[model samples]
Target chain A: MDLGALFGNFNNFLDFTVGGLVIGAIYALVALGYTMVYGVLQLINFAHSEVFMYGTFAVAWTFVLLHGTGDASWSLGRAVPILLVALVAAMLMSAAIALLVERFAYRPLINKNAPKLIALISAIGASFALAEAMGLRDRFAKWFGLDDNLANYVAPNKARDVYSNPVSIQPHGLFHIGGYSVTDVDLVVVVAALVMMFALDIFVRRTKFGRGIRAVAQDPEAAALMGVNSTRVVQVTFLVGGLMAGAAATLYMMKIGSTRQNAGFLLGVKAFTAAVMGGIGNLRGALLGGLLLGVMENWGSAVFGSEWKDVVAFVLLVLILLVRPSGLLGEALGKARA
Target chain B: MLLEVDGLCVNYGHIEAIRDISFGVEEGTVTSLIGANGAGKSTTLKTISGLRKVRAGTITFDGKDITHARPFERVLMGISQSPEGRGCFPGMTVLENLDMGAFVRKDRKSAAYRSDLDRVFDLFPRLKERERQAAGSMSGGEQQMLAIGRALMAKPRLLLLDEPSMGLAPKLIQQIFTIVTEINQQGTTVLLVEQNAAQALKRSDNAHILETGEIVRSGTGHELAGDDSVKAAYLGGDL
Candidate 1:
């Protein structure tokens, strides 16, 4: 409604745009998991949110384990190595959780040819189970007599308390674009996300393993006849998705500075929306959708106030769906073109 | 025999789709199964390729009992199928589809693999022209070619083709059957399932006629093609 107020301050607009992009990068990474899984199995792994959550915990614990806590000052060179370690730790944890979810929650149902609705219920159950486990981490640690320091770091309280980043890497302005300054955080988030995405794109297009994924996505029976182990492909898909989500989790921690037991829930929903917006089963679409959604949400907040940001994002999704039901890039993942 | 199915019974849930059908594909020969839509021809091939579970059967490939082998294991054991409905990966390019067929092979980048690819391209020059094109975007006939060519990429000793001519033009169907004959002559055993009985029987070394879920007749290709009842039921009477 306040169009003039929204567009009047060009610098503010630019700042919001950059902010949106930083968040969008994380969303894109998480959304890739959703899209890739949907492409192959046609099942939305609702537990994927918990996978991202575990990654956040992994990052936080890694910093704690390295004794980097409480606003520790470090040079850029040292900070980079610590961040890399956290990223790897997060990725491994998330991937492990994802595989476990697939093994226990989805695979049995798939093997049994259970109803799609049943699989969805199983995913929701897994999501709740994982979230609750994280929420009750302190109780479990106490009961098990976990190492005092490690337990304190992993589960500070029994409730859903925020876990602040232990490593404090100061943000410095990298450059100015259109009178809006870009920070190191934004640069890292955007660049890292893009690099991972492009790498995934290349893997899907060029590698034999990736070809097996596409084949299974298109026609599992045909793929099996051709000697593609559909089970392995499905497992690898989960692992790849989990790894990307983990990377996104690390970037999210870097930008937001903290995480909670339920942190992944809202962001997971947003990322899933991004996936659908780009086209639910498409990889490139997830990227496009995430960035666009982020920009739109920020611009909407400028116009309608911050409280209306979520409304704006959802509204935009509705409008986009009305115009292009398949999504911006279209649902071509399992049908045609990687 | 390159492949053997004895007393094979397959069921979809409780209802039996294929019932105690026994057949064999001799090495370096083309065997055809001609049947109506629900005559269990596809089910038979699927079971042989390990895509369908056999309720009661013994499948032996090159003297190895493969009754419990997984689909990929079957493929690794030199059995490949261009399944019913031309099950080409629509998302993949023609070349990618071929690469997927060779998924179980260790020498995918070797000269042998390259020569196999060349052999496929030689068989269907259209595929070579559209190697980078998505399989879904091609014509039905072209997809059929890609499916068969993809199966050939596996370098299988026994090729199982189900309904390769199912939705093709008559001319294209003839071309596909010709290629099947050529593939057979190249020393790969073929077990082809087709609705085009006349062409199938003409090219095949042996033939079987399936009705409902059982094989009601079986003989050499020429003998079945000349049989009066076979002509009336499947070959449009005059033939």
Candidate 2:
């Protein structure tokens, strides 16, 4: 790790900065979902990352099928349509998964007046069950006709470099400007994340459903008095959050070019850290906290090398809590409790 | 009758709060339910507002049965309540609270909505000065005004008020009761629950005295105000 070599290498810095932006974007997407749900319910849906995980596999299968149709000619033009279809499919899948989880797992716990800690444990259990169900390679591959040996061969747990070719569909080479070399994938992730964030922010702050969500978040009983169905609003919150997580999953697969079974677990944790780091219930806080964390974590890794990447999240979380626990953009503990 | 509650019973887990209380509020009249603390006055109002669990009987408002309707549904069907403890959405502004109140109404962005808001402001001028202030940041009286204004925004056919004068100064109590009479005079039927039996009876057209979860006495406001036992028990012992 020559100091001069690493500094002179614009590619690594690009991977750090640009990669951080894209990854931070996904984290922000996932974190927004977490923040919105937490804002409304004050309950963490730990299964959200598993929802992301399943979505990655769902999109991957779509891409593989598209690739098998002799459209192995992957280009920026082709990636766009494939990405759109895959995202919609993945969104529907994740939304259904979220609805079921809420209907059976969370709703029952809420009805039982179960402690918050128990709800968290149930969420973790659900996450594990979903992961296992998804990792059964042949079960999913049978649909793609990679049956028998080929089906078992394309295992999800394998390393990203398992392919001999290790395909690198670079988006027409990285463009350089000043100290940054912004890749096509980086632009895609960053733009998608921002678009999604803006859409959600508008939806929560502007739309009728958004007002209902805010009212429900503020006071469920009062929200109900206004003829706002608090329960339905809550369900829609989960549904929207799940949809974002699914889209994040698809963009993540495109950015990384590969994924693993446990991909979303660490990302989910970090994204959740982003949500908490920003203020659990505030929307803009989640996005700011995520991007800030992404940039800082990369900068920290640049200073201390790779081993310190994981430490960055914890250190920043503690420092933020010590200085401003409500997050950078969050106010006092007003609606955090509600 | 505008609002009829028959055999209404409410329980908290195991303990019963109200038992078979029956009442009818005629259209366009101010009806008040006054009782001592823990006598189930608020519970009756909560049941009518669809906020509490009703273990028995039916509630009909404007000839439509709405016993199992959701709280929001009740609001949409022209039934709204200013809840106890001044349950305003604390994080929101006065205007936002009013917006939430008008959640079921279509064309909320129309000029008519703004006019209704102006009416609330005219009724409670204190609210106009603090339109942007958070509801929780206001004083008790201001919060109460916002609560009533919020209920008015719903354009409810029946307005249920739970202890509107609780924790208010005597001067503020008089002001609120005066406004309550005015609100009723404007064609909004009010069913108010109050611990200030004398003031409530003085303000309402019809009155009911609740004791131990049952209506112990019912009459015109002046009759209850003149009754000796009612005065001895509730009006500060013959004040």
Q: Return the top candidate by TM-score.
A: 1
- Please write out the lDDT profile of model 2 over residues B1-239, one tens digit for every residue: 99888998889999889988888999998899988899999888878878787899899988999888878888888898998887788877888888888889996989999999999999899999998888888898899989989999988878988899888999989888998988888889999999888889888889999988888999998899999999988998654
RMSD in angstroms, all models? Answer: 1.9, 3.5
Return the interface RMSD of the candidates, in order shown, one decimal each: 1.2, 3.2
Residues A75-186, candidate 1: write the lDDT tens digits.
3456787789999999999999999999999999998899989999999999999998888887777777773655547555644788877766667787999888998878
RMSD of 2: 3.5
Q: Model 1: residues >4 Å from true position, as ranges?
A: A68-78, A147-149, A154-157, A334-336
Question: Using alpha carbons, what is the TM-score of model 2?
Answer: 0.91
C-alpha DockQ of every model: 0.81, 0.59
lDDT by residue (A69-167, candidate 2, tens digit) is: 232435556578877888887888778888877887798887677998999899899988877666565566667766554542355434232221122
Give the alpha-carbon lDDT of every model: 0.89, 0.80
Off by over 4 Å in 2: A1-15, A69-73, A137-168, A331-338
TM-score of candidate 1 on Cα atoms, chains taken together: 0.96
